[model samples]
Target: MSAPYVLVLYYSRHGATAEMARQIARGVEQAGLEARLRTVPAVSAECETVAPAIPEHGAIYATLDDLKHCSGLALGSPTRFGNMAAPLKYFLDGTSGLWLTGELVGKPAGVFTSTSSLHGGQETTLLSMLLPLLHHGMLLLGLPYSQNALLETRGGGTPYGPSHHAGADGKRALDEHEISLCRALGQRLAETAKRLENNRG
Candidate 1:
């Protein structure tokens, strides 16, 4: 059997969300699991428009197989009108096959988001991401109050998941608290997955 891995899947527009994904991946590796970073191509309104097979930079596009084989998942996206970005949703909408087969059942999952403003729907975006994962029967993981960053964060941190406030220009770097929360969520998912796998064994 292949080694267990956590899929850190995301859609990044201004790059803040992508940085969060990297921090989450770092935490996943800290907990001794592989982190497979993947991103979705942008969606265009025009039906004929298609993204290139290979992205110009950042993570490669995600495949259904990536979602299928992941031992755990950390989903991230920038907030778009209090919701996850269309690209991430579009990619997830294509996952009906996994849902039908229950391929993701019992796996641990978490969500994160970045927003242009502090009140730019960070929590709502995270919640939006979780809905589809719930339908897949995955065990949802959130940051517990025990994490100091959740309480101390001035930029973005939530019980729903990690969050970042990128400022109106979308250039503000993630604060220490936000980064800590992101790493915390990743570690939590990895540890929970390990426990679940051991139980099955």
Candidate 2:
């Protein structure tokens, strides 16, 4: 059998969410799991618009098979109107096949987001990402206050998951606390998934 891996899937605009995904993937690797980073293409209003099969840069586009076989998941997106961005939602909306087959049931999952403002719907965006994972029957994980960064963060760390305030122009880098929380979520998800897999074994 192929080695188990955690899928770090995201849709990044202006790069903040992508950076968070990278941090989370690092944490996953630190916890001794493979991290597969994948992203979705942009959404276009015109029905005729289509993205290339491979993205020109950054992580390659995600496939349903990645979601189906992942040992765990860390989903991230840039916030849009207090919710997850449309491309991520668009990608997720197509997972009905996996939901029907319960391919993701019992897997550990967590969420993260980057927003342009402190109150720009970070938590709501995170929650929005979790809804579909719940439908897939995945075990959800979130950053607990024990992480310390969650309490100390003035930027965008939250108990719901990890978040980053990318400033109004979406140019701010993640603060130390936000980065720590992101890593913590990734490590927690990896550890939990490993434990669950061992139990099954």
Judging by lDDT against the true structure, name the best candidate: 1
Q: Looking at model 2, which ten-residue stretch has the lowest summed lDDT?
A: 44-53
How many angstroms is residue 17 displaced in model 1 relative to the true structure, after the best TM-score fit? 0.4
Tens digits of per-residue lDDT for model 1, 127-198 = 999999999999999999999998888999999999999999999999999999989998998999899989
**lDDT comparing candidate 1 with the true structure:** 0.94
Q: Which ranges of candidate 2 are over 4 A from the true structure?
A: none
Backbone clashes in each candidate structure, one number apiece? 0, 0
Q: Residue 186 error for model 2, in Å?
A: 0.7
TM-score for all models, in order of appearance: 0.98, 0.97
Q: Name the regions of candidate 1 deviating beyond 4 angstroms.
A: none
lDDT per residue for candidate 2 within 1-201, as digits (tens), equals 678899999999799999999999999999999999999988877862267878989999999999988999999999989888889889999999999999999999999999988998998898988999999999999988889888888999888899999998989998899889999988998899899989989
Clashing pairs in 2: none
lDDT of each: 0.94, 0.92
